[model samples]
Target: MKIDLSEVGRPQSPGARAVNAMTCDVEDYFQVSAFAPYIARDSWPTRECRVEANIERILALFARHDVKATFFTLGWIAERYPQVVRAIVAGGHELASHGYGHLRASDQDRAAFDQDIRSSKALLEDIGGVPVIGYRAPSFSIGRGNLWALEALREAGYRYSSSIYPVAHDHYGMPDAPRFPFYPNGPDGLLEVPITTVRMGGRNLPAGGGGYFRLLPYALSRWMLQRVNQQDGRSGLFYFHPWEIDPGQPRPEGLDAKSRFRHYVNIGRMERRLEQLARDFAWDRMDRVFLPQT
Candidate 1:
């Protein structure tokens, strides 16, 4: 597959560089897919106590690794945990929107998704003091069913998005999409930086980041990221939740077999793997990597 940055709505930077982009979905443990049913969004305020320590651990890890990532915060989270939002900004990380209530893009039409994005962007900007330009759909939910959301994002003043996944997964994946950042021609020409992947036996397996990075062995994850940079000659995007680093979070009740596996498969290894990634690669914020080629 010939990877091009054009469809992602921006030109690639001219020079030899391995880009490592990392982000965190700032939501509490119960907001994840595994526990969404057991815990409703309206009840998120009550669970605020569960996330404070976990976020602290994440901030400390970022400090230790000397890595600066974009925190795609949920509007609900900012409304409840302004202190956490302030600390993340104070720690020198970028703040971006992850939707208002952790709602999936597929669940909403263009209008609803637009409302979510705009609302979330406003909240994050108010709390984080930066121009919110990036978005990652909740659970990578902006798939074929809602590719139209890209246009909404652009119109809402977003410069780029990391919502599409190139690999085939149960929840979200645009398998044949561009593997690198490109100028996706939408309403406002938004940059669609699909999550990183490497082709294997005719399949674009996800290796850039997420559960696969946490569940798999550190060596395989490292190899995949290095391969994305070496073979594609472009920066790779990686993402994880702040809760992923919080090994001590309470396990929600009523999780099915698969949901349990997906959320908690490699909880203990997340911190170690993150440290390894930070040390092995040349990392940069999304803003740094997404600049247009002059």
Candidate 2:
């Protein structure tokens, strides 16, 4: 996504601001769906598990900044490391689902998708001791072809979602979708809070967090977020993985050039940039940022 650097000098949001959402997709690097080609799910037990240590680093960072975020956790990790899940809740962060086993909704049939959501939600709520009303599909997998996922989410008792990335991508994106939160296909009362994007040249460009944040200059990311809040009057939902903050974690072999580049290019710089992000804006949980007033 091309950012119009001209907006870098834009002013902050005017009085009465909406705090942007800060989120973490709580999955270990080995569990990344993109690496499925190189890593075997059954072998997940053999790989060195870094999610617990990485999560603690993230939790300490948030605590240092006094920021509260929503953690979209994988059911597999939560089930194996229930203490880590409990720690997230005890740290004053909202816990939500990132699906079981990181399976994409597009890759699953309706029955499988339904089972994934129900079981994941049950596990999260059971361990975290709170309702898991928010969910984000693994890798923003819900798109134009899977609007049925929205209905299923509502039926599964999910009140909101942040699963659709509005910008175009080789793997996942709904380019024509709205940049901010909206009800996809008019699914009644089911809010689909898309990842934030900036509109320019009549096309939506992804400015929200993820690999884009890692690839872009911090100044540009900051500018686009400010533009979204100050000019568009919207709350930005920024997301990243706990693995993003752990540069020293083990790197799997046999990765293609593109995969290796995308995953490892700037791993060393993420934590410091995240520290700046934590201080730059007021952050809150996803539900509080997107949910409507009574």
Model 2, 149-259: lDDT tens per residue?
888899999999888888889989988776766765453557888898999998888888888899999999999998888888778889999889888889898999988
The TM-score values for the models, in the order shown, are: 0.91, 0.94
Candidate 2 root-mean-square deviation in Å:
5.1
lDDT (Cα atoms) of all candidates against the true structure: 0.80, 0.87
lDDT per residue, candidate 1, 22-137, as tens digits? Answer: 77888878888657777886776666456667778878877887888888888888898889889988998888889998888888987788889998999888888879999989
**lDDT measured at residue 135 in model 2 versus the true structure, 0 to 100:** 95
**Which residue pairs show collisions in model 2?**
none
Off by over 4 Å in 2: 1-14, 185-187
User: Evaluated with TM-score, which candidate comes out highest?
Assistant: 2
Q: Worst ten-residue run, lDDT, model 1? A: 1-10
Task: Please report how far candidate 2 places residue 267 from its true position, in Å.
Answer: 0.8
